[model samples]
Target: MSTVKKTVEVDVPVHTAYNQWTQFESFPKFMDGVEEVTQLDDRHNHWTTKIGGVQREFDTEIVDQLPDERITWRTVSGDTKQRGSVRFERVDDTHTRVELVMDVETSGPVEKVGDLIGSIDRRVKGDMERFKKYIEEHGTESGAWRGRIKPGDTSGPAL
Candidate 1:
């Protein structure tokens, strides 16, 4: 597995950023390579993406979530193997820092070579940067799912 971490500072409040992040279905609008994301349930989602000329589909289960804090997930079945988390930190009333970390495994030799060359890191960073631009330019969330995932509950995080 390979890990990548990226962080961005957004000109929005923690709550606003956190709320916007919860709206997973809106990802395709700004997230590069994410063809679609469907919120199957509060804790499950279907994702369609194209990376490095390869199209892949996956169902992800939320492993942990805490409002205005963090969201973690793992792919249950898919063309790729990965686990990751997005964390939100309040820098001030109108500033937030978003950090994302992922552990990924490529499916084949070609994909592995691409990954080793830093394609995945660059792509993830680009996605986060685009997300920052999307939210800041809009000045509000496209939609929100204001739910909380408490510690020790283990039923996946709330969105």
Candidate 2:
């Protein structure tokens, strides 16, 4: 596994930033490689993405989440293996520093080369910057999910 971490300061309150981040289904608007994201339930999501010219699908389970603080998730079963977390830090009432850390394993030689060249990290950081712009301009999230998920509850699908 290889890890990449990036941080960006957004001109928004911690709550605003955290709330926007929780709107996973809106990711396609700012995330370049994400084709679609469906919130299967409070703690589960289905992701369709194209990376390095490869189309990949995955179902992710939210491992942990704390309101206005952080969210961590891992792929339950997928074509690619990845686990990551996004954290929000309050710099002031209207300023927030967002940080993202991802651990990923490449599936092939092409992807390995792209990762080594820092393309993946660059893409992720760029996506976050776009998200900042979108949120600052809109002043709110497209949608939000304030639901909490317990560590071991797995049953029906409800977004």
Q: What's the CA RMSD for each of the models? A: 1.8, 2.3
Candidate 1 regions exceeding 4 Å error are 150-159
Residue-level lDDT of model 1, residues 1-159, one tens digit each, is 899999999999998898999999999988878999999988889999986678999999887788889998889997789999999999999999999999998888877998989988998899899989999998888777767766457665554
- lDDT, candidate 1, equals 0.88
Angstrom error of the Cα, residue 30, model 2: value is 0.8
lDDT of 2 by residue, 73-125 (tens): 99998888999999999999999999999999988888889998998889988
lDDT per prediction? Answer: 0.88, 0.86
- Model 2 compared with the native: what TM-score? 0.91
TM-scores for all candidates: the values are: 0.93, 0.91
| True-structure lDDT of candidate 2 | 0.86
Candidate 1: worst 10 consecutive residues by lDDT?
Answer: 150-159
